[model samples]
Target: MIGQQAIRDWLFINGKIEKAVHILSSLHSPDDKVFVNRKEKDGSTSKVPCPLALKDYNSNMNFVDNFDRLKKDNQCDRKSHKWYMRLFFHFIDCCVVNSFIIYEELDTDGKKLTNKNFRREVYTGLLSRKLVDVQSPSILKKRTKSTTEISNHKPHVSKHLRLTESKHQPTQISSRRCAMCSTKKKPQRTK
Candidate 1:
């Protein structure tokens, strides 16, 4: 208590800091302190005082730390020269890890599959599925031709009259491939 007024609830670490830090915690009120390393103005490390909550959070972020460990060590994402490929593989790895966590929670049986085993099982299941012909990647068109046919009105001398009168309609021969059919990325398809 300072005279008649008393500060409550929030911890402030402002002394000898380039930037002031304020932390409010329901668990820890102000006046809680633990010895922590701090860099002096002379650029030397020192064990200065720190809040118990901040120290605890640094030492005990178990789930996030565990995920970083798993991704770095166990994930099968490969290094690629293509920036997009690297991002894609990393995204796939994150999905696998997240799904494994969900599977662990949803499982009622006492038996639990290890992360490696879970990944392997998923890989095999994906490979075993038969892809449909229409969903296959990279279907080459037999020939490229403009499918639009103009109306049977002959062009008169006036350019404006021709544009206003003429109507071009798409002639349906075979079902044209979907927009993504010819691209060499993921899936190709045709009817």
Candidate 2:
């Protein structure tokens, strides 16, 4: 599980790195070029232009190697605790939402923006969306009342009672009524 989590983390990091590089590339002017100039004492000069910085280009390989290491470790199958899985899902959702926000902020028309302001706008938009999945009012009221009742009791609610009262009730055989005849019946013996 640790290995899997590490792999996932690396993938997410790589995605962020890609986005960062894209943002940096887009920020550059169309005609910008890195030039190596050779000048003699007589002031005659020649310039060799490079499309991209060699050092900057080489650093991406390091990120690729990190990703490969994570993949080779093969740790994703490890059984994780429920809470860890929940947190992982939450992190993934946040990343996806943020990625969308980044794209939108970068692609918007005629707007001069800083990264901090862009992130703030995205977060505000996310907050304004009615995305939370709360239960209906009556269901919430019932849950609140039940929780309060449970809390008021000195000891915790009994395991059996809790199970019975859970949102997903356990399947139970209630008196085993015959489907054909309207009568409760025991298992019949085969002759």
**Highest TM-score: which candidate?**
1
Q: Which residue pairs in candidate 1 collide?
A: 136-188, 137-188
Candidate 2 clash pair list? 1-78, 4-75, 4-76
Error of 1 at 85 (Å): 0.9
TM-score of each: 0.42, 0.22
Query: Residue-wise lDDT of candidate 2 within 1-191, one digit each (tens)?
Result: 00111232121112222233322233233344466565757999977553343224544678567444533332223355788886675564455445644565578676755444544454556552322232455865665333322345343333664554444443435754334333336544334
Root-mean-square deviation of every model: 18.5, 19.5
- Can you write out model 1's per-residue Cα lDDT over 105-133, one digit (the tens) per residue? 89998789988878867775665232211
Error of 1 at 59 (Å): 5.3
